[model samples]
Structure formats: structure tokens, C-alpha cells
Target: MNPSPPLAPGLPVLGNALRMMGDVQQFLVDTYRQMGPVYRVRALNQAFVIMAGERANRFLLERGDEVFSSEVSFGGLNSEFGMRVHVLRGRPHRHLRKVLATGLSRDLLAARWDDVTAATERELAQWRGQRALPVVDRCQRLAAAQLSVAFTGANSAARFATLRSAFELVLDVTIAGKWPAAALKLPAYRRARAEILAFARSCLAERAAHPTGGPADLLDRANEAKDENGNPYPLEVRAGMALQGYFAGINTVAYLYSFMMYALARHPDVRARVLAEVDAAYDGDRLDFERLRGLPALHGLVLETLRVYPPAPGSARTVLEDFDFEGFRIERGKRVLVATSVPHQLAEHFPEPELFDIDRDFAAGRRASVYAPFSVGSHTCLGAGMTEVLAVATVAMMVRRLTVTAPDRPLRITATPGPNPGRRFAVTVAGRPKI
Candidate 1:
């Protein structure tokens, strides 16, 4: 009989949790080097069999839903995000995704272009004359302000802070692990969650009263949704679902926007290319989706940033059935981790993987196995298409008018449970010199 897959040895009781906490991507890479592609690591009393490299990522992300389950893998999410569409599995997931497609579709994004562009312009204007500001912090606030209005019709300045706080606290809770995160049970986090729920509740009530015309926010779309059985979801579920979308939209977009900005600051040659493309793409005073797509430099910058530092570096799926993986007999109930960061960095796929090359040919099929910032298959990110458009537009808006410079110290990229610019990464944004 073939021996079981190797288990990564770690300190007693603590297991690999400490290393994982210290540096998730590096720890995974080290473990892979020491124990081959398949290995198990115990963390916080749970064991996870990690699969590394392109093939492993493909298998874990693309396998049949009958065998692997996202709901089980990310069980921690339901407690926080509720059983929203992102956490749904099987038929429920499929149906919800279909319903959400209407909201997240490209057409909806195109229609909302003016507001999103205007929001980014305002934030960029605010950034000017700043001495030094943490890119992540500013980006999160800007993203929250933009999305809160776009997603929930909360356009008040006060509402932006509340929404931003709620999303950030929830993300912090997710990072701190369930028990400790629960134990601490900070009142601020509690208050934020309550506010989020309340806000969601208000949106639902308003949607119900109108039931016809209003801003094309997320709640509006969700309010109009019907399940496969032609039944409307409960008000609470719709609220929860809309809240989850707000949390996801605000948080993930903040990270993506920050990373793209950070990349432009750190890489001057690439920055020049992006500025050139932005200038050439927009001669008109008004910006639109078509104008945004005309920016190949900014588009490539977004893709390269995602490849280098995906907001979420890894994805997990809990095995529901016994399966054979590379000669090793894996058992059910075990969580399978697919390292997205590792595959993106693999020398086999990306030559000189360490270098930040913005001009790489992403159109070719090479990205299929090597790049998956949004994961793949049935559980792929519902906002994938919209996210691409938003990222491009936001970056273009900034690069078109401003020049961002990184601090003298090399900007550090670390994960605050997700890839983020470390505390010291502050960039100075100033108006571009007129040419």
C-alpha cells in the first residue's frame, strides 16, 4: 500500500499556526520545499492537507462540486458573512449566482461608470497635498465611500465611516480565528456588525416600499431577485446577502486598488507606460467603460498586480469523498488548500517570477494554469468581471491626473489575513506635471 502523504512537522500544540500567522505565503512555500507537493499541517487543532504548484491549484479549484465543497471548506465564513451567495454550495450556489449575475453583469457596471469614475476622482483630489498617507488605509476609506453609495445608497460622509468600520472589523474577526476572534468580542466590532445589519435592514425596507424605481444599487438588484422556484428570498436573507456583498465589494476592491497603486509607485517604467496609455485613451473630458478598456497599460498593471499579490493568496475546499492525489490516498473531511501565490510564483510558469513585468502576454492560454487571482470553476468570484472593469477604471482615473511616489524605504507586501501593503507603505500623490 502506498504510504500516506507527508505531514509537516511543527511545534507541539501550536503546530504550524504560528508560522502561518507570521508569513502565510512564505510558510507554505517552505513547507512545500521541505515536504513535496502534498503535505499536512495542523493548525489550531485542525489538520489541512496542502497542495502546491499549478497542477495542484488546478485540481483543487476545478474539481467537480460533488467531490469538493466550498461551503465546508470556508465554514468559518457563514458565521460572519451568513449563508449569502458567496458561501452557498451546490444548487443553491448556482441559483444564487445566476440571480446575482444580473447585478454583477458588465452592463450594470457600464451603466454605473459615471458614478464610480466621479467617486474615484473625488478621492484622488483628496489625496493631493497630502504629505504621506498609508495607501491601504486611504484606499479602504475611498473604496468604502465609493461602494457604500454605489451598493447601499448610503452617500452620507458619516455612513462611509460606519460602513468602512463594519467591513474592516469583520475582516479582522475573520483573521483572528474563530475562537480568539469570538473571545475578544470587541464591543466596537459588535457595534459595527449591528450597524451593518441595521443599515441592511433599512435598505430592504426602502426597497420594499418603492418596489419600482430607485438607484441601481446592490439592494435594488437583490430585491428584484427570484430563486429557481420563482420564490422571493426572505427580507432578512436579502439584507444579509446585500450586506455580504457590501463587505466583499468594499474590502476586496480596497486591497486590489491599493496593490495596483503600490505597483505603479514601485515600478517607474511601468508607471510611465500606464500614464502614457491613460493619456492616449482619454481625449474626452468624460470617462466611460470604453475609454477605460482602451487603457492597456493600466489593464496590464492590474493583472500583474493580481498575479504578484492576489488579495487572497489561497483557497480551500473540504473533501467530501475519498480521492487519489498524486499516488497519495486522501481521506474525506480533510481540508485541501490550494496555494494560489505559489503557482503564480512558479518558475515553470512565470519566468523571472520575482520581477514585476507589466507587459507579459496575458491573452495567451498561459494564464489558465498559472494565474487565478479569482479562483475558478463553479465557485469562482461572482464579481470577477465587474471587478476587472472597476479596477481598470479606478486606476486609470488616478494615473491620468496624479503621480504617486513610494516612500524611500522599499514598500513591503504582507498579509493582514489578505495581501496588503504593510504599515510602512505610504505613498505621496501629487498632480502630474502638465506636458
Candidate 2:
């Protein structure tokens, strides 16, 4: 029998909680480097097997569905939103993913380009000539606003604060694990959840009222969705599923968009390259997904930024049974942290990974084993393709029409549960500097 993974140094019941609480991505990356691919971390009563690097990623991701369960780990999060995609396992999960594919497809994203740009432009309009705009807050508002229009066809600007507060509180308790499970019992959380549900219901009702003869959105497809048995999903399930985009994204999108914008601001050369590509790629007012494929610098910048600043810590899953890999054992019901982005910053795979160089050849070592920014295998992010497309296109829009800058300041990241641009990351914006 192989020995259990070594436990990281920790104090008393707190274990690694203190260090893990701040900058989880960097802490995990640094831990993966100092402690090998497999190790154990404890926080009070909770314990997790930290797995990273290529071999661990292969064993965990490629065989994740069989050996691990998402619902087991994050059922609480899923339950709050009443969505199954974030919690369900195996066949049922695949079926739901297929059902929702129509909404998440590239074609749908292309169709929603106008709304995407409109939301972004609206938010940036407020930032124009503003002193010290909070990038994370602005990006969160912008991302959520676009998510509202693109996903549910809802104009959510007025309810943006409620939406942000609700989603942020839920993630803090759930995926972020920053708040205790009992945090959900607080009046603030309850109110937030109620508002989210109410908002979801309104989207459903609006979609039902005007079924067709409009640009198709997430709610439209979901409203028509039949489950695996070719029967309509229950109204409750449909309602939950309608807000899946907001439930699963928003924060991640906000952080990602925030990081990309910061990267463009910090790297003038890269910014110029991305701006030039965006300037030429536009076909009048229409710059769709396909149009972005030819822009190497812009695409590379997005990938590089994600590699550097992974929004969330890592994919969370709970082991279903006792298992051993890499000469170590993980017990049944043990929480597992698959640090998928570990390799994203690993020197062996990325060579001077700290340096931001977008033009580097990525295809050479782009296999899932070595680089999984969105994770790998069965539960790979459903919106991965669309998310990438959105990143590429949205960054283009930012550089083309706005200038965001912070003089004599370097990027700083704060992790409430996962990393985000820190307060000092505030930037001043002046509208559309000459390209």
C-alpha cells in the first residue's frame, strides 16, 4: 500500500486556512512547486488532497467523472441556484450540457455581439475621463450587464447591484468557501437568493410571452428545452437553468475581463499589437467570432493573461472512493483540489512563466495535461469556447475605444476566495485615444 500524501505545515485547527485565504491561485501554484504534485491541506475540520502538474491532471481530469463527483463537493452551491450543470455528474450532466449548447454556441454569441458591445460601451461611457475607476467593479458590472442581455435578454442595469451582491455572496459561501455553510442562513444571503430567483422567474415569464420572432437568447432555448426523455423540464428546473450563465460566470468573467484590461494597460507594446489587430479586424460595426481567429496578438494576449491570473483557485471535486495515484492515496469523501492552472505557470511547461510574452508559440505545448486554464476533461467549462471568443472580442473593443491607465503602479491581486484585481488596480480612463 502506498503512503498517504504528505501534509503541508500548518498550525493547530486552522491548518493552512490562513495562507489559503489570500491569493489562492499563487499559494496553490507555489505549494505545487514546493510540495510536489500531491499533498494534503487541512482547514479546521475540512481536509483536501492538493493535486497538480501533468500526471496528476491526467489522472484527475481524464478519469474525473469515474473517480470524483462534483455534486458531492458543490451540491450546496448548485442547490442555491437550483441548477444541475454545476453539480450533476456523468450522463445527466452531458444531456443538460447538450440541451444548453444552443444558447452557448458560437453562433449565439455572434448573434449577441451587438448586445455585448452595447453593454460594454454603456459601462465605459461612465468611465470616460473618470479618475481612478475601479477595474474589478466596472468589469463586474459590465460583464453582468452583458450576461443579462446576451443570456436572458434582460436589461439588468438597474438591478446590477442586487445581482452582484447576490451572486458574490453565494460564491463566497459556495465555490469560494470563504464563508461558512451557515452563511447562507443570514438575512442578506437569503434576500440575495430570493432576488436571484425572482429575477430568474421574470426572465422565464418574459421568454414565454414572446417565444419566437426575436434574436434567440439563452432563455428562449431553455424555455423550449426537453430533458433526456424528450419531455419539457419542470418549470422549476427551467427557471433555475435560465440563470445558469449568471450562476456559473459573472465573477469569473469579471476577473478575467479585468485582468485582460489590466494587461493591455500595463504592456504598451502588447496593447499596440492588440489594438492594431482589432482596428483592422472590424468589418464596419460587426466583429464576430470568426473575425477574431486571424488576430494572433489579441488571442495570445487573452491566453497569456488567463495563464498569469487564473480567476478561480482551481476545479473543486470530492473523491468518491479511496484511490491512489503518484504513489499516494486519497481517501473516500476527501475533498480534492485539482490545481489545473498549476501547469499554466510551471517553469517546466511555460519557461519563464512569470514573464508576459503573448507571441510565444503556444500550440507546441498546449495539450490539456500541461495547460488547462479552463480545466480539462469531462467537466471542462461548458462556456469555454464562447468565453474565449468573448475575451478576444471584448478586449478588442476596449483597446479600440478606450484608454485605461495607472501611472507608476503595478498590477495587484486580492483573493476574497479567488484572485481579482486589487483596490490599487484603479485606473483612469480617457475616451478613444488615437490608434
- What does candidate 2's lDDT look like per residue over 38-109, in tens digits? 999987667888998888778866688888988865676667777777777777789998877777777766
Top candidate, metric lDDT? 2
> Candidate 2: where are CA atoms >4 Å away?
283-290
Pull out the clashing pairs in model 2: none
List ranges where model 1 is wrong by over 4 Å.
9-14, 44-46, 81-83, 152-157, 168-181, 184-187, 211-217, 365-367
Which one wins on TM-score?
Answer: 2
The C-alpha local distance difference test score for the whole of candidate 1 amounts to 0.71
Candidate lDDT values, in order: 0.71, 0.78
TM-score to native of every candidate shown: 0.90, 0.94
| Whole-model alpha-carbon lDDT for candidate 2 | 0.78
